[model samples]
Target: MLTLYRPGDGPWHRLPAGPKSLVLLVIVLGVSLLPATWWCAAVAVGACVGCYAVRGAGMRDLLRQVVTVRWILLVTLAGQLVFTGPETAVANTARVGAAVVISGLLTLTTPVSELLDVLERAMRPLAWLRIDPQRAALTVAVTLSTLPVLARLEREVREAQRARGGGRSLRLFAIPFLVVALKHADALGDALTARGVR
Candidate 1:
């Protein structure tokens, strides 16, 4: 579910990131902004999983993925259920959340390189505007890659602080990530400049 290092030799794993990203964007936007309906939502989820199955994804691995992402979706769905009529709210929550889950499924199925390629192809139209699309795509891809690393760093930092008798607070969680991000951003910028990529 965390999708740490689920490497495989499947066709999806070989897909370029750019096309996969395009598919993710289209599906997420379509499913999220469309009408709220339980049946529709169920179909969307099934379609996502179907893609995995077609690509030879196993049940246990997919279940782990669902478990990893379900925590937030479940909480949101719970709140939605409490605030609105059960029938309407439940349907709407499922529709919206299924979109999110589908997007995650795309990410899990597609490799990051494929995502980059997708982005590059997408940004081709903007070439007339003197935009470096690959650079832009790389920026996004790099940010995505950094998310888990930063999360892990934040967890380690918090645990170290707690071990030293530090109290829990949002600030403790926020500060370490922000500081680390800033430092890394600077280093990345410097590297890009050195390579004439900036």
Candidate 2:
């Protein structure tokens, strides 16, 4: 959500978005390619995890993010554990966790607008193929902006369900959430049109 970006004078904040993104990609790929050994993957994951402390994020903040992605991680762990083994499962899970943490760190340090600018600049050469970098970057920016709105909507829907009591149907929230999301999209589109984004 919007919780990703934290305003501070940290070293990560001082780094350029391009290099940070490149390093993040390399680190994630390198970790993922490492052997599924406890010792090897653990060291890499530990280093990635320690980035939170280096970037001034608190334990509570890190735990909140992990909790948000718990379901996805749980499913991945269960599948790996069943098909492979405990060692592979743990290693794969750690790899995924480290990748997510590193990506989150990038977003936390870089502002969304600046990240979009970096993306646009990187994709400028693709304009020769009729791919508009500005539009592409704007799409990503809008997508990032919607995440926090969706998260807020989810929380509100959950609270409303709890207030009503005696029911546990995902449809109870999904339908309303979809409706609100569509409305948000419509508004966003209208705003973009007004601004002559096209």
Best by lDDT: 2
C-alpha lDDT values of all predictions = 0.66, 0.76
Candidate 2, residues 45-144, lDDT tens digits: the string is 6767676666456566667667666666799899899999898888888877777666666666788878899889988998999999999888877776
TM-score of each: 0.67, 0.85
Candidate 1 TM-score, C-alpha based: 0.67
On the 0 to 100 scale, the lDDT of residue 125 in model 2 is 96
TM-score of 2: 0.85
Cα lDDT tens digits, model 1, 119-187, are 677888888999889988788767666655655666677787788777787776677767877887788
Clashing pairs in 2: none
Question: What shift in Å separates residue 53 of candidate 2 from its native position after superposition?
Answer: 1.0
